[model samples]
Target: MNGAPQVQRRRGFIMGFGAGAVAALGVAALIAAIAGDFSGSNLTSQASQVIRDEYFKPVKSSVLNDASVNGIIRELRKRYDDRFSHYLNPHQLRQFESLTSGRFSGVGLTVTGVKRGLRVASVLPRTPAQGAGIKEGDLITAVDGRSLAGVPTEVATARIKGPPWTPIELRLVSGSGGATRNIRLKRASVAVPVAVGEIKRAGTSKVAYVSYATFSQGAHGELSSTLERLDRHGAQGLVLDLRGNGGGLLNEAVLSASLFLAKGQLVVSTDSRTMGHRDYDAIGNPLSQHPTVVLINHDTASAAEILASALEDHHLATIVGTRSFGKGTFQEVIHLAAGGALDLTVGQYFTANGISLANKGIKPDVRAVDDPKTPQDEALRRALAVLAEKMAVENR
Candidate 1:
């Protein structure tokens, strides 16, 4: 179950063309001619133009003006291997905004599609799903009397989410051939926690264990406050868990890393033909200098990878678990005047050590894989052991 959706930080402005004085005058004249045209035709033409001129790679002129906006995006995705870029219609834009802001209207159940139906992976605390007695491993066979046997997970998830106070009926079977039951739930706004923290006793040491869920808006503030609160409680070390974290805002990643790294340390850097090169540095005072261990898995990606790589490169934390999900690229959300927006891949980011995490994810210093059959979290236990060793060395 993914707690946070993967999204990139917002850049303040769109890329502007740099032209010679005479060329700039000509471009200005052309802009003046098209500025008054606010029709759908004008919007489509403008979108095509932007994609042609500003995309990371060159696009053929033939694919620019498709009959529909969705058609254009589909062609781009199929032809150019552009998996990240897409056009969000007005409704989708609102949903995206709601998710990035850490709130959404849903039953608060995360499920994965299976042959039978959608398998419930988790039910968020205090949510409608939890109130309705939905449990992990439950097979959701139908929604509103419609069988979801072969439906895609995304489609099923969409059906589960609706306007607040709206009722959703789900038919579910208990794990692996248990009883079947139907329940009606009213969707409500769910506020996902950016970070959940607890202090654990590892041997004689008190280690602060924090599971950072996403890099969404205001995530840095929540993480910083959590760290501060844990630190005040006499925690001696830290175990940062980033498993299943798909990632969110890039700026939030940098700001979250700033809570652990020293001021002026480079967090990440970006490069592209249109956006050029830029470096992000840590800006705030660190909350703790205690020995730290970061837990990662194959699901960690994008901004999560950025933070993990920064800490690893700076020798600030010992990375544990399997390799991360490589997602080195960055995206920019450009809002359109005619509603909706273009979420386009704008550039690629590098870690603090100048390594691109595109197809190559960060390798952990200490590797550990958990066995699902057992209830114990082997990776987390390994992290605690590593943290104990680091703390012992520091005490010496």
Candidate 2:
């Protein structure tokens, strides 16, 4: 279960500083910032002093180089209590870049952090994790025998991914107390599609079912193509399935929203302290004006939330299923001079109606609970019924 320790070992030299004292000073500064006089500049100055002078560990001049500085900044960001802010070293940065490219080598599982530990949020179909029976809500204790408990989701993800055809073992326990078991899975290159569509023959008309995996750079193009094909197949209505989607690029979200909205419609807007205010407008022709439904669940987040909120606010689609994951903040990746990068949450985004889906997610217009016993999709069935009723009324 042991890999390289998360914390790097101190190699030489002794610094004449007490780590306990410096950590206390940091806490004091944090308290002061909370109490008022909270300038980011002041916080940065205090942090610099603690790292340069107060840290208990010896500070080597050679280690003070860019790479070490980046590492220190990463630790500082964690202390800053901003969960969305992250510093990626060069290797981690490359790994991230690979994810956004729509292809990567991994066990095909997505995870998230919670109070208990790292939990498996979803597993992609036909992947190694799915084949090994990894289920949602399973608490992942360790990767390759190394305990991932208390580790950040990003770090855990890094540990799980590797070159294709490599084997990685995951030790996990059920949501409830159960036997701890390890499952070995071979990592494979996963080429994720942005969106996939199929026409379902429902009574007199066909219902277009489109499921989007992530809002990567190619999302808009994929969405457009799918919509076009569905329309050609005489799809009378649409079910935009976004369950378990964690979301991706902001621009892709806006573009996806544009597929249902008309030109000049505001897709999303942002309110920021550092970057000021900004708005995104739809510029493409809508695929159809027919009745549409958006399927969402608790795992649907970030860019996916943006699109759902926009469509719901505009009364363009009837949202069914459960509440969304409520992640409305957007991050900006700033490349450091040290070949690494910093992803900082710089702003909060709002729907077309100016509603912020931060901690409070968007409520579904039609709440449909999941029915495990039914062979049919409960949410999809409800959505199809709603669309059918709408179409009937329109014909009248």
Candidate 3:
């Protein structure tokens, strides 16, 4: 379990979890059978059965099951000091799958939770939300007839997303102290852009500007193709932006680093208590040799940090912006026998130079911070400036 095969096996496991309650029960029975004594070793399951039979009030089995699994995760976190490990219910698992797959059925708006409701961050083009005239800065106070006040953004988002062609209503307030207006729209399948690219002029140097929202499925391919296209279009330098990316598939991160790095170069190494040590290396030819600068901020984490650290350690790119969000740990989503999954922290990852980014994030070579109140992207400007300097040096 130390190469591409291992990575593929991990990905396959995540995508191939058996469906339905029967599959769950079958796995649970197997575990109990392996223990050879269900009554003693499987106390949690027995307790659940007892609660279903003897509880004073009525309770849904699904609710009880979710609670039991979550309680286990909570105890594990406290006992093992693993803050990142948690359980995802079936609905949450579906959302996670959709997010990593880069598609979801929704009205097509990105929102963050606020005290009163959800704040519309950005509206995707050609989507139902945009068609209905929802704009950035709009406050969504309710979904359908239910008030979204005090609701977490994830929960509110789940409520908004449903089967394609389904109708949904939102009550919105435009700007602060604005009157609320209800808007109704139909949900549609929205393809989230994992990687986006363009060419921007930095001084006389045309730089390929690439931004990754996440290292989801097909992200490396998307980034590779975009960089190739931009290189062909006469981009003299590159600005790789990973400002708010949280990360996704680990293989995607390895493959993405392979895009810029020479074949067989080390990308990252992980040390797991169970999986042991494994090394991931660049596997493909370099996309372009253009002078590069990488942009990172407080939100750049996990796989993004891995890529940035690789390039920085190899002296292939100049890192710009503030320190990245340190997240050196990697998690494995293990499908439970009773539905849902346990996203357990399985290992710690090291950068190309063998540095652990836990708590101590990647420091920018040219630190620049962007003020949210301002319209200008100061950090991006600094990135472009760094790219221009590198291009100048390369041309000399």
Q: Give the number of the best model, judged by TM-score.
A: 2
Candidate 2 weakest ten by summed lDDT: 1-10
Q: Model 1, which residues run further than 4 Å from truth?
A: 1-68, 78-80, 97-104, 109-123, 130-160, 169-185, 337-339, 372-374
lDDT of 2 by residue, 244-279 (tens): 788888899988888888899999999889989999
Which digits, one per residue and each the tens of the lDDT, describe model 1 over residues 208-263?
Answer: 99998889889999898888899899999999998867788888999999988888
Q: Which stretches of candidate 3 lie over 4 Å from their true place?
A: 1-55, 58-62, 79-83, 90-104, 109-160, 165-186, 393-396
Give the C-alpha miss distance for residue 46 in model 3, angstroms: 6.3
What lDDT, from 0 to 1, does candidate 2 have? 0.76
Steric clash pairs (candidate 1): none
Count clashing residue pairs in model 3: 0
Global lDDT of each candidate: 0.79, 0.76, 0.80
Model 2 CA deviation exceeding 4 Å by range: 1-82, 89-104, 113-118, 175-179, 201-204, 338-340, 371-376
Candidate 3 structure quality by residue, lDDT tens digits, 187-300: 999876877899999988787999877787788988888888998989988899887676778999999999889999999999998999999999978876878899988667
Order the numbered candidates by lDDT, best leading: 3, 1, 2
Number of colliding residue pairs in each model: 0, 3, 0
TM-score of 3: 0.72
